[model samples]
Target: MVNDIIADERSPVSASGHAYGEAERREANLIYEYADHLQRHGHRVARQLIQIPGEPRPHRTDLYDTSTNRLIEAKGTLHREAVRLAIGQLFDYRRFLSPEPALGLLLPAKPSADILELCRALGVKIIWQEGGGFTESSGG
Candidate 1:
């Protein structure tokens, strides 16, 4: 059940070999894809990008749940380093964005115990995406 409505435009890639400007766009796409999937199942979803003042113009956090009014941060990882990077970024963003009661969605190649423990230590919830959809799991 896919209900994707492409509302945003993509940003041009930068010349540094790093798609810096496209991070938010990529995150938005992931959020929209997930939200659309949920919406097809009759759940209302709202996605937002939290931009903290005086900090980097754009911060992490692909989507947010408007119904529950929860802040959701999405992380896509294929390796340990990627997970570490995402976790570190999430901590920083959580501090800066200051979203009351923040939850993190870790989209990893495989679910690792170490990752879950880290999220728990940071007081963040976990959501794992496997197969074609996602499942919430206890961090402990």
Candidate 2:
């Protein structure tokens, strides 16, 4: 895994002309923090690179929990759009991985009721910061 690229706290890289904003920074921090939380629980979380068919570049996952066999995508906010985007990313990332890990979404806070239902319907585990640790939705 890329030596925990996001965990290194390096300057953000923006693909578009605009620079990285607070939202991007927040998402990166959330991913890093959640990965640390997973580590303390004796789980091995690592960044992953996937080369999709007909794609010239690789896509990087926020973190993959090797111990639990789950792939996680983190979003900075609980907004519907953000969660929707994360869901899309997890699905896209899943098809290319060899072991087909269970999908997870890490958020800064618990999502709204509808959002929670949406994730549940899609079989996406919702994990959010709670107290000093993280809380995960039941099932996959």
Candidate 3:
């Protein structure tokens, strides 16, 4: 439901419609900052909308690198619950992308060691904000 909520947030609706709390808003800002950072690094970033057959609505991925087939899912935090949700989203988005790119997670900060381990086990690259740039963990 997070995706659905966020999708609504992109529209002109009541705050209660999206219902993203403070942490969620902060995380959304991080995604914007991350996208700008990537642009400065020469990576063309764009949102990818995935439309499933017979589905009335489509799902949107946060950022995708057109130059390099990389799909990125951004999170405000890499806490346990956020990571879990991101993993599911990355997988779902990947299936719909043409040529299915490599998947990555963008976070405001590095997560706990255990969470990083979980990402590695799932084969999702971890990229966290560092200073004004981003650091890649290349999770196992």
Candidate 4:
């Protein structure tokens, strides 16, 4: 699912023929690594695709933990813009997810206090790297 999105978003070279290099690819790899961490900890994870209304091609979610019914949106950074983007995507994708799983945002590290507050206000769980492993907050 993620591969499809990466393929669609590919635009390595612009009109100027300058290569914008590995940022996107690295972000994808980061998400995959996070997914792997979940699986290693005994979570049953899968990449999910949501069929957009009136759209032929579906949108893919970063990770879905079937056992816990968590829908996670992975972001390479937890800055304000990235956090906002992930929140919006998660909310939009939820409408198409059956049974309405718990929403979560997976980040490389903990976000700013404001970002954390926003997720808490929206009732979105936050999973971020801390020390040598990942940490989670209920976003309550």
Which is the leading candidate under lDDT?
Answer: 2
Per-residue alpha-carbon lDDT of model 3 for 38-66, expressed as tens digits? 77778777778889889898877787877
What TM-score against the true fold does each predicted structure earn?
0.65, 0.89, 0.84, 0.81
Candidates by lDDT, descending order = 2, 3, 4, 1
Instruction: Give the least accurate 10-residue stretch of model 2, judged by summed lDDT.
Output: 1-10
- Judge candidate 2 at residue 14 and give its lDDT: 68
- Which is the better candidate, 1 or 2, if ranked by lDDT? 2
- TM match of model 1 to true structure: 0.65
> Local distance difference test, per candidate?
0.58, 0.83, 0.77, 0.77
Residue pairs with colliding backbones in model 1 are none
Winner on lDDT between 1 and 4 is 4
Q: lDDT of candidate 2?
A: 0.83
Q: How many backbone clashes does every candidate have?
A: 0, 0, 0, 0
Where model 4 places Cα greater than 4 Å from the true spot, the runs are: 1-23
Error of 3 at 17 (Å): 4.0
Alpha-carbon runs more than 4 Å astray in model 3: 1-9, 12-18
Clashing pairs in 2: none
Q: Model 1 over residues 1-140: C-alpha lDDT tens digits?
A: 22233343334555566675444454455566677766777776654455777776564355556555455665554456755776666666556543454666646334678777776787666766668886766652
lDDT of 2 by residue, 12-44 (tens): 666675778877778888887887777777888
- Alpha-carbon error at 15 in model 4, in Å? 12
RMSD of each: 4.4, 2.4, 4.7, 3.5
